[model samples]
Target: MNSQIKKHQACYTVADYMSWPDDERLELIAGQIFDMSPAPSIKHQNITGEFYSQLKQKLKGKSCVPFIAPVDVVLSANDVVQPDVLVVCNPDKITEKNIQGAPDLIVEVLSPRTALKDLREKKLLYERSGVQEYVIIDPLEEYVQRCWLQNDGHYGASEIFGSPEALALQSLPEVELPLWEIFGLEPPEPAIIWSG
Candidate 1:
């Protein structure tokens, strides 16, 4: 619980969120305000940048567009967030002020301060909002966890990928992420198999 909740008696909405100072880094989840202070670590930024760069390159000239954080993703009037990295395929959702709907893919690089919220509250929000795919990267652990929206409209069990593996995106079948490169790790040597 690194974030402090705003002490408003009433649940906040986008209109209230928009009225706040632009300098304040905050997120509204189900109308509750969560502070996003003490900016992320350098390692977090590095991993986020690398992942975004990879997605951008792979999605170049494609219908989907990639965006990094500080851009608002307005899931609903009261549910707005700024995911670390996101890809939105629908042009109509890309409004001048903010993204109007759930993005096709979202990536959140976990920091000590925001890990719990990202894994719990944000996960539920993204799932409920119909985000096609959600990816969580732990810079410290050098691993990734992914959740894809199931047929029944819920996220299925998370699929874990270690630093040595590549993650195939469900929302965009053409895209794959090199976890080693993303984590800035040396690729593990191939295991030598001997004939029995």
Candidate 2:
């Protein structure tokens, strides 16, 4: 291998990652840098916002806190990521700067720009980092799949949910998200009706 390439592959730590320019988005996985570009689509943003709002509403006055994107979750010195949505039940792991460890539940909304990495690399990273649950949302397909960390420290079989049913968070069963509402397929029940 060439010296320049080898030098670049020497595995950057969290300190190195923090020192880089923030003009564009990037992720660090296993000491490798992955560029996040092309910006998110409208559907992706909408889906992310829906999930965040629902989760935030459910977690109100609760120990578990929900965070949206651009919040750094530091999995390791060599691995850091910004999940679309993350819920942390453990207060100690959270700090003003970033999450110091794995969150209880993490959600990533799929886009053409990040589908592969979110499913493959980020999946493995979260599993290894001891995240209790990982959810992948495909906005275009209107499907959500989740995998829970098994007792053996690996992810269990995936549970897929499509339109027509609300998504029940295994980590937070009390919180049920109406998928149809989130995807904007069905109108929310009318709050009130006036008859004169």
Task: Give Cα-based local distance difference scores for all models.
Answer: 0.93, 0.89
Mark the regions of model 2 whose C-alpha exceeds 4 Å error after superposition.
1-7, 187-196
Tens digit of lDDT per residue, candidate 1, span 1-196? 2223345447999988887777778999999988888899999999999999999999999999999998999999899899999999999999889999999999999999999999999999999999999999999988999999999999999999999998999899999888999999898899899998
RMSD of each: 2.4, 5.6
TM-score between candidate 2 and the true structure: 0.90
Which TM-score value belongs to model 1? 0.95
Q: Which candidate has the top score in TM-score?
A: 1
Off by over 4 Å in 1: 1-7
lDDT of 2 by residue, 145-193 (tens): 9999999999999999986678899899799998998898984465687
Judge candidate 2 against the unseen true structure and give its global Cα lDDT, from 0 to 1. 0.89
Enumerate residue pairs that collide in model 1: none
- What TM-score would every model get versus the actual structure? 0.95, 0.90
By lDDT, the best candidate is: 1
